[model samples]
Target: MTETITGLHDVADRFDAFLIDQFGVLRDGAGPYPQAPAELKKLRALGKKIIILSNSGKRSVENSVRLAKLGFDEACWDWFLTSGETAWRMMAAETDGGARKRCLLISRDGDTSPLDGLDYNRTEDADTADIVLIAASEGDRYDLGHYQTLLQPAAERGLRCLCTNPDKVMLTADGKAFGAGRIADLYEELGGAVTWIGKPFPDIYDQAKIFLGAIPPRRICAIGDSVEHDIAGARMAGIASILVETGIHAEASPTERAALFALHEAAPDFILPDFRL
Candidate 1:
């Protein structure tokens, strides 16, 4: 029963701030959407506060750089928040309390920025690691089976996995690819415990609320493409939501989209064909 709309301007006056998703809503990994920058500028001109709520495994600074590189105006958004930044802050704040944990990181292209200033020791062997950090997926290079084999040792040892990105699929230059969340799911299937640290989770929303100052939850809206993450997260956070059909669910048929909504047990207040002005 979601109302269909053309773009953000349709509901511009209904909200004071927006928690916008980055990956599928703003860009497709390779470039930004054609109307995205203009849409952002329009929202900014309307005196709306904008925050990029991304489930990326990279830090906020990295995301901001990427956005700028993609031709987005830096003045469009007031703040940028990513699950990786949230996880990094949490990890950095942890006091080893005399027992430093050994971490085995699984990130795209071996990026270790998540652990750059952390106290956890990095390990190359899963058998020697105390916890598994599923920050990003190398889906473009390896298959899910590759991860299953790589993580079996850690799973056998009952190591906990901290998944910074909870996206099940990532948009690639070619098409959809496996995401870090899928890898975390595999670890759970292999009997390893996983701690999700991204969208659809309360921690990230709580942090977004802090950044939003005293904006009432009822006056804020979240826009994203994933039913499981964006829409569901908004429901859990007690805010309005808008579903964009330009990201993970871009190609979903009517029946498939219905199934997804039912499966997630959540629906957006409004739906848009894409993120536009």
Candidate 2:
């Protein structure tokens, strides 16, 4: 039988390794949470193999550099995996023709996150893009009208649309739901097919697990902010999960937390408010 996770230490004791979420629990979009890096170090000292399982839509070099700045270096986890890397590779492979190296990207405005070989053009330069890539942008300035103007026509002309992060919205520390997953949701609504490159999809998770040197599923803990991706993916892989209460759908009150549990009707083996313990 399964159970609800109550404390960080309780869950940590049960697993030999952890696959944690980045944007919400460990750090916000702005900076690192003080408790997160410390918790990661503690886990490392105890001999756990830690991997930052992120839906970050950027290259591995960019991801590694950012994590190092956030203090996730040799002292913390042993590995880091990004949705950006997976998505880019998949997109690069899937399209054999149609302007081999060009794509139109809709990510956070200041984002230079993709891999080295992946080529891109701005929406303003949509006339030249061969593929339309939609992720989360920085501000609300890039709305439906923006996507329609740049991406819709490309879709109609049979160009591929790639969604980097599958999550629609994320919870802020102050408690707000904001994310890029919504754009993917909408594009799908408009009958545009997209290839999700993040978790809840076995391809990425299996690849991450292999990075752990062939660890068994039962020995791993898939921790994250969202139930749809983390929990559902863990279910498919037969691994346990820990829900961090700091990301999208963060718990403002214990009662609200319980209600969320009820809504998903799926319980995390452990619930961490932050990375403490």
Candidate 3:
């Protein structure tokens, strides 16, 4: 059975490093959680190495800037890593002899920073593109049916999709909303191939291990809100995990929570009501 705790203080001395998730664990889309910054500072004071491990589709620098704007001090964490940054680095290091592929990008608010330094050409027409990139979610502005129609052409063309954010749901200003991973799921259902690049996958964890330096897996703890991504991924990476209740499943009933754990076949080592000291 998983142990429940009030805050990080309960297990502070158990781990030397923490891999914290961004969206649901630290803040919602609108702003930072009230006690988050202070709690992080407290952890830092205790000599705990912190890394903001996120499945966000934006690059690491962009996320850092957003966190700063949200009032999180830069001194709270040692380094930041995002699935988008990891994917970008992988693409940059690829030695394929083929020419640059034409990319049809789908993102929230039309942001294209994921492709900023890449060699791929952006395309508006799906029929003419060689690949599809699902970087962010626009669920607030459009429905799933809209995405199904928009991606049908690309699916018919068998364009490969690279999904940097593998979170199926996200905490938005209006509560829960579909994330980019949902769009990627729709593409797969439409017969298109997809390559997931974020949490619950090995690539991002491999990169995170490098950033975490010499910390052994036993001394590392991953804290996040999603059981599918955070808890499951931590298990896959051979580290301890803590699930906070103040994020994506904040309102889930006890029964619903149990079903979710059963569905994912993952249980966190600890559970907390929020991220606090």
Q: Lowest summed lDDT over 10 consecutive residues: which window, candidate 3?
A: 92-101
- Which regions in candidate 2 have their CA more than 4 angstroms from the true location? 1-7, 92-99, 110-115, 119-128, 171-177, 252-265
lDDT of all predictions, in order shown?
Answer: 0.90, 0.69, 0.89
Residue range with the least summed lDDT across 10 consecutive positions in model 2? 115-124
What pairs collide in candidate 2? 57-84, 58-113, 108-137, 167-181, 168-181, 168-182, 170-178, 170-248, 171-248
Q: For model 1, how does the per-residue alpha-carbon lDDT over 163-189 read when each residue is reduced to its tens digit?
A: 999999999888889999999999999
Score candidate 1 by lDDT.
0.90
lDDT score, candidate 3, position 126: 93
Backbone clashes in model 3, listed as residue pairs:
none
Among these predictions, the greatest lDDT belongs to 1
- Alpha carbon lDDT at 109, candidate 2: 52
Cα error of candidate 2 at position 117, Å: 1.3
